[model samples]
Target: MRNNGSDVLLTAIAPIVWGSTYIVTTQFLPDFSPISVAMLRALPAGLLLLLIVRQLPRGIWWLRTFVLGALNISIFLSMLFVAAYRLPGGVAGTVAAVQPLFAVFLARLLLSSPIRPLSIVAALVGIAGVALLVLTPRAALDPIGIAAGLAGAASMAVGNILTRKWQPPVSLLTFTAWQLTAGGVLLVPVVLAFAPHLPAPTAVNLAGLAWLGLIGAALTYVLWFRGIAKLDSSVVSPLLFISPLTAVILGWTFLGQTLSPIQLAGVGFVIGSIWLSQRPAR
Candidate 1:
């Protein structure tokens, strides 16, 4: 293993960059179909990475790759869009925040990682902070949206654990490429059947797609999978707290969204929880 500090820092960048997705999607791709955007975001990046690696799955890896793809990318992204469109952003985000806790338990069940009390504490704090940061008293919840959020969180949690458990005999880049490509491929029919034809993209829309495909999907997932392989799932799961934190900050900074005192306090909680989760258990 290399420097734990460096691994954490590098892995953390993926989610931080992901925080910009909401901002970019709204400002540039607002009129785009969510499923189509997801497909575009995934497929191009997957193909680009495949081109670089020039590798394909073999034997059982074929099934494993697709399963991971469905859990991690295709289903997760689909549920994310469904929740975001059907429910308030805060409700969706907070509900999905359960992912860390789910990861902890899933790791214990699947990977036999220790279930430390500190891990539970950190996960709880992280969830509370996200709720504070995003949830609104007036936010209306739809049953389907709530279900999607929960399912998405569980899907991602299982995917994270499975990635940690599988340890594919390939470089992180190849592993990432396989999952992304598989996921994008799975979404082809969904987009074709459900989504209408997209209008010709302007320069800004193309730029947004480029950033999401190149940076958000390809680069970020590479970092994320690297983290999953190197770090304990408990350690890596809490890092996702940074995504919502970054989102809130971006909203305030770029979108001129007002941050309440509660949200600021939630920010503190999130930072503290992250730091706490990374601490080695005594």
Candidate 2:
């Protein structure tokens, strides 16, 4: 029971940590390029963790690591950065929050998890809430940003399913280290090819990068995997619904962004959906 309590606490915190990424990226990181930021976040943190772990995965685990790395870290973060850059933070965040829906659908198809009716309804409600929050006439409607956010969510969903399917023998830290390393390696060429010249890193940017690499990617994954290991996906995944709300609040507080009445209503819907999704089936 104590272990369960710890897992729940950790799971709840992971998304809140992730929610800060938007503010960090927009305010701190250099305006060099999204891919560059993504690479830096992954590479250094990956190397640090790998050095600490020092035990490499073997056999089929290598392939699994690569696939998970691509889906979870590389593709997901890269596209998320792009969406954040192109779209309003609220829009990007709200779109990314659709991850729960994607996760539910993929879990059904891949993990053979039961797709409860309430889960589907909750997902749709959440989606509608996000749409209300983000769709504004003043904000530039970039199809590319929308596409990137959805793709990132899809990648995350696939990665979540894969994490369940391919349970590595290593500790959560070790597994996360390998995945980060693989993702960083995959991103290197892309970053080099696209963003060879980086912007001068300011103190603020460096601080943001450090927080992102260390806390957001590294510590968050450690906690996330630990929670997933201890809890059922049904219990663990819905906790992610808190992420966008955190983003919204953070955006409002730190970034001085204001939420419209409709957007506030949207947030209520999202919270309601998340709560509903977490309840045990009747």
TM-score of each: 0.95, 0.93
lDDT of 1 by residue, 1-282 (tens): 232999999999988987777677777887788788888888899999999999999999999999999999998877876776676555677778899999888888897887899999999999999888988676788999889989988999999899888889999999989999999999999988988688799999999999989999999999999999888888898998888788778878877878889998998899899998998867
Error of 1 at 35 (Å): 1.3
Which candidate tops TM-score? 1
How many steric overlaps are in each model, in order?
Answer: 0, 0
Score each candidate by Cα lDDT.
0.87, 0.83
- Looking at model 1, residue 82 earns an lDDT score of 75
The list of candidate 2 runs beyond 4 A from truth reads: 1-5
Worst 10 residues of 1 by lDDT: 84-93
Superposed by TM-score, candidate 1 places the C-alpha of residue 155 at a distance from the truth, in angstroms, of 0.9
Q: Per-residue alpha-carbon lDDT of model 2 for 60-166, expressed as tens digits?
A: 99899999999989999899899888887778877787788787878888888888888888888887887777677877768999899899988988898879877
